[model samples]
Target chain A: MDFDAIISNLPLYLKGLWVTLQLVIMALAAGFVLAVPVALAAASRNLLVAIIPKAFIYFFRGTPLLVQMFMIYHGFAQFDALRESFLWLVFREAYWCALIAFSLNTAAYTAEILRGAIEQTSFGEVEAAKACGMSKPTIYRRIVLPSSFRRALPAYGNEVIFMLHGSALAGVITIVDLFGAAKIVNSRHFVPFESFITAGVFYLCVTFFLVWLFKRLEHHWNAYLRPRETIAVPTIAATAAD
Target chain B: MRKLVTAVVTAVTVALVSTSVIAGEWKKIRIGVEGAYPPFSSITADGKLVGFDIDIANALCAELGAECELVPQDWDGIIPALLAKKYDAIIASMSITEERKKKVAFTNKYYNTPAKFVRRKGSGIEISMEGLKGKTVGVQRATTHDNFITGEFGEAVDIKRYATQDEAYLDAVAGRLDLLLADSVAMDDGFLKTDQGKDFEFVGPGYSEVKYFGEGAGIAVRKEDQDLVDMLNKAIDAIRANGTYEKINSNYFEFDVYGG
Candidate 1:
């Protein structure tokens, strides 16, 4: 109904989209890096090695992301020691707090995904690597981790999309992410439907783009799982015999 | 004789009840309130809603002889909820802005207060464009204070709009905010009086710019609720004349909130 309002507020929405993009991309990158070591630790045979990482993953995964963010943003700020300490520079800003919360939360979830994939790593593959006299660390590097990453690709894609939606919460801490921009526009103009619908459209577009991007990534990563293309090679050999 | 007296009393009581029911039309009314702004309307520790606005809402309902229900709503959604018929009236400390008048009718202001900025004591922050430039200022989202700061100092200040006054106060206490702009009374009673606000003090002079702050806080209802508006206006007058308003006022503030 308010096309004009939507049209005029595009710049604000674009600005918000940029913030959202920055937050989600940075969080996902950080989470993925953290998850690799966490997944390895959690998938360990020794309980002592695994318990701490397991607890960390469960703690982040079980609680609400919003509460985690509030605890970091609002809860951490209540401490005088933390405020006076050198870490206060990072803890003082809402952007860093949100980024920390998002990264930790996604890391927990991704660690579980990678852990499951690691645990399900084909025994035959590891045995074959050992038969070749590959060392434990070398085996993990050359065989186990890469295969698990390939296995984890589809689920990791889903996690990435989930993280994108979760990034909307950044606005709560006063970051002008996409949803925050919509709230500002709605409050300024009092046109809730127009403002929010525009935000929803932006989210939908990003989500669709993520889905397409992941589909491509999955196709490339899991190419080994697909049936081999023998038809073209067989046809060429038959022509040579003729 | 006792039986006859009981019968007579019952008859008179029933007659009074019937007459009052007939005279005071709207039987059931729902009022929306923001349970976040302290000393105005906020939830207590045990989850009971208490404050001056709650007291006034109760008194008005008593005066109207209507069963009232108070619906705690967030500030941003309060007006939209009223328009959507989520509640019959909003007694939240909503300023009677001309912008709001386009969508809803307002009763005469039940209370009025000017907006002010608060910062850390001895911070020596000047209330000017050059002084506040690039400084982060927090305000409750969608409020008259938000409108004023965004309009008057949007370019000069980095405005952080919070969902509630409490959040803004929290940020101010956390030192995340360089300044906070809110109703002078709310900041005084809600934050500055609290232990967390010990280091903070009001900075700029109180602002009551007619274009932004409007004519104080009023009871907001749907545009079609003219009859309800008239009834509420009359009840407001009755409470003021009968000293009920003063009793509610003194409970929250030391001085008059019914600004001239």
Candidate 2:
């Protein structure tokens, strides 16, 4: 209700906003890169290659990300040797631990989405490319990958939004994302509604911007599907006449 | 076809009605706790819930002639969950702050501890604000410790907030955090017992800021449950007057760690 109090905390909220954005951007980029290979393996004909990635996806997806984060951040530290080892440097910071957990979890879901989209690509297009004497690698590169990416775009957009929301969990492990910042404010001010509502608005703005961007990308990719205006007008007239 | 649809709908309705009736029958009084604060409440190695809060809660329930069940809830969601009737009350060492008082009623303070800072041994760090400048300090999220650290250190210190006290302690032990700020009793239990904790030490004199820290740890109840709060306060006072409070206190903490 106190607009001024909420306005005063804008700087802290902005700092949190920055951290949330960084986490989402970094996690999405790294997760996408990791997902491409996993998706490829999942779609591969070889059982061994396919099974390994499938298991990785299954384990990460089956367990909650909070548990996965704890396992990576705390459970991994339980071993004395791990603490004394060189890898301790990476696992020591909460930021990297959170980044790792988010990336792995996102990778699992992204791989599944990409795999679904890749499989949904038209078989006729591949046959046509083969008839043109295109090699297997060339056909995949020129046709399959592009079509799959286009088909996967919408799902990938959803994934991006999910990752943004997931970044809120960074606060659990000690990273001061937006939710973390709001929590600090809430604890200090004892105004949960004000702090949380401010944080929620920030998230809404970020998600809204992302949705708009994705919609634009979807329109751009589907430009070919837009019927020529002249033909569309005649077809509509003919249908009306009929 | 219509008769089949009607029969199916009747069956579904009967099933749902029975389920609700069964759910409405109270078997136990569910108690929600953060489970991250040690000595007060924490998860044991065997995945069983144990600690001072658990013992006190069980004792209180026994005194009230009611069955008790423990529910692990995140600190941030604890109060909301209680309001939503996810649990009957909160026994999570939740301080009775004035702001929170607006939402829920609380029994009298049961336990209290001064806030302190813990840095690695041989780190040569003091508790002074200047010493903590640009240093990463860890504190449990949504706690008075978190509020105090941020207030005292401000932008000078990079405060890392954690959902649980254990997580912050782990980070401190792993050297990710320069210092750990928490309730003195909690730090005493966490750092004084563990092998890694042996290398950590509390710095300077512990203190409390009443404005932000609130009163002390107390059982949180619904605002409408004034009768329940009265019963609890009476039991709490009785325990404190007798040797019961001291007995429980000595089991987990040294000296008298009560009052704000």
Candidate 3:
């Protein structure tokens, strides 16, 4: 209720906002990149190719992110050999540990989403491509991937927002994200509601921006679907003639 | 539709099972404490809960003629979990602040210690706000140390908040933090004894702001548990009078650190 406290703590709130943004962006980018091959492996027919990534997705998704973060940051550090290993350089820092956990967790969910979308792509499209004598690699690159991405777009948008929210866990491992900063303010001012509300608003703002971005992306991707003249039939007819 | 029904039925079954287990009668009192706060409460290597609060909780339950169990909860969630009925009472070294008084009741203070800061020895750091400029400091999340660092040090030092004092201590030892701020007794008993904190030394005079740090650590009970609070307070007073408090205090700390 006090505008004074809110105004006074704006800088700290901004710092938290920045930290949250970094965590979300880095985690999402790394996770999406890792998710592509995992989804491919999961969808493949070969049991050997599919089993490992399938298990990885299942294990990360099954356990809570808090436990995963702890196992990586604190639990693994208990081993003296781990400290001496090359992994210590990354494990020693809380930020890297949180990043690794968030990336893995988001990758699991993203892979599942992408796998579902790839599976849903129309069988007719593949049949048409094969009828045209299109190569398997070409069929996948041109038809399967694009259509699957379009199908998965909306769901993937939701996942992006979830990843942003999940990044709050970084505060637990000592990364000074927005929640961490709000906690600092609460402890200092003894005004939990004010500080938390401010942090909540910051999160809401970021979420709104993400929603807007996804909407734009969805619109851009759907641009080819806009009703148009049948002139496009000429190009199709030429390809058919060939 | 059959799959939907199965999912719903399974969910309902699981919910009922869990609720029944949680809603069971108060045959045994489960006490919550931050296990990293040593001499007061801590988790042993074998995962058993021990320390002053553990012993006192058992003793108090003996007086109440009830079986007592200890539950380890992170410091930040301690109060909310108690309110959520996850535990019967909190014997953790929780200070009684006026803000907290609105939600929960506290017994008389059984132990008290002023908050202080610890830094690496020969780090050339003095115990003043200016000395901490540009240094990174650590404190337990949702604690008075977190509050004090922000209020006093502000942007002069980097404030790293952790879920446990032990985590903060680990970071401090790793040089991720230049200083760690916490209760004097906790620093003395827990951190000082740890191999990582051997080179760490306490700097500066202890400070307290009643508005944030509260009126020292007391047993937190539900506000409705006025009867329970009275019984616990009586036992606390009796123990203090009979020198049991001193006996427990001296066991963990070399010097008496109670009654700040």
Candidate 4:
């Protein structure tokens, strides 16, 4: 009911939203880069290459992200060597620690999502690539990876939102993301409703934006699934209206 | 038609429960305590909540002639939990601030302590803005200390806020923080005197400014529970007048912690 409180705290909410966006974008990019190799290894024929990535996936996916963050941020200091080493500079900062934790955690989930999408690819497309004298790596580069990415769009879109929400936990380590700003506001005003509701709106807007974005991407990439009339030139206005 | 019947029954049940609650008098009370702030209220290794705050809660309950049920709640959620009726009162060492007064009522403080900085034995960290410039200072987030540091020295210092005082202490031990800011007694008895905090000493001067530190930590209850607040204040006065408060004080500190 306190509209003044919401209006006055708009800047704080914006700052928090920006931090959350930064964390999610950076984490998603880093996770995607790391996940490709991990997905490849997990889908490999070799046992040794597959087991290590599998174990990593299980470890990160099985444990909670908060616990992993604490281990990297607080647990590493227990070692004398680590404390004295150059790595301490990176490990000493809560921001870097949170970034590392998010990147590693998201990589696991992303790898699994990619792996599932990759498995869904038809054998015939791979056979066609083979018939053209394309190497395994060439087939993966030209056909498997691109198609799987398109197939994985829906789930990956959900994960982006997941990472956004997860970024709220970064406030626990002192990085003032969206939830952290709300916490500060509530602390000062003791009005949880006003501050948290404002933050909830920010989250809602971000999520809606992301959902709308991926819908357009899905429309463009999965043209075969769309009507032939809309295939030649996908109009932004149509997608936006939809 | 069936949905309407179900809704009618639910509404009737809810009304009955509300009427009984409003008409009833206070009997047994549930008290929420943060079982993490040591010497005030913390869980022992055996899972017992024992500390100065817990003792005061028990004494107040005895004075009021009511059975007390203690609920351990995390510090961050303590206020929300109280609002949600998870407990009737919060006996945690929550500082009595003007901001907090809007949400909850408080009894007279059972104890008062200043905030202080803890650092390495020879760290020579400055407590002033100029001295603390660019230095990392750790504090438990959402606390009066966090607010004070951020509001007062935020431009000069790199403030690292943790979820708990213990986490700040851990970071200080690991050399990740140049200084740790928290309640003087909590740092003294809870960490500074302990083995984990042996390398550290209470550095710089203690701070008890009303603006930042607020009033001393007090028991908080819903504003609607004014009667409970009055009852607690009377109980606090009775114990302090008698020898009970002093006995408990001695068990924790050598001096009168109330600063009376």
Best by lDDT: 1
Model 4: per-residue Cα lDDT at residue A79? 95
DockQ of each: 0.46, 0.29, 0.18, 0.41
Name the lDDT of candidate 2. 0.83
Task: Mark the regions of model 4 whose C-alpha exceeds 4 Å error after superposition.
Answer: A1-3, A230-242, B1-26
Question: Compared with the true structure, what per-residue lDDT tens digits does model 2 show for residues B1-260?
Answer: 99999999999999999867643443357899777778788888888888889888877776666678889998877887887888978998887777778879999888877888888889998777678778888878768777677677777998777767887777777678888888888888866577769988888887777787777888999988787788788878777777777888889877887763
Query: What ranges in model 1 sit over 4 Å off?
Result: A1-3, A229-242, B1-24
Q: What is candidate 4's lDDT per residue for A79-120, written digit by digit as tens?
A: 999989999999888788889999999999999999888888
Local distance difference test values of all predictions, in order: 0.92, 0.83, 0.82, 0.87
* A69-93 per-residue lDDT for model 3 (tens digits): 8888778777778778888888877
Ten residues in sequence with the least summed lDDT for candidate 3 chain A: A183-192
Ranking by DockQ: 1, 4, 2, 3
Candidate 3, position A235, lDDT: 75
Put down candidate 4 lDDT per residue, B97-168, tens digits, no spaces: 887887899988878888998889888876777889999999987789988888889899888777678778
**Candidate number achieving the greatest TM-score relative to the actual structure:** 1
- Residue-level lDDT tens digits of model 2 in A177-225: 8988888676555466888998999999999999999999989996676
Which pairs, if any, clash in model 3?
A: A187-B147
Error of 3 at B140 (Å): 1.2
What is the number of backbone collisions in each predicted candidate, taken in the order shown? 0, 0, 1, 0
Better of 2 and 3 by lDDT: 2
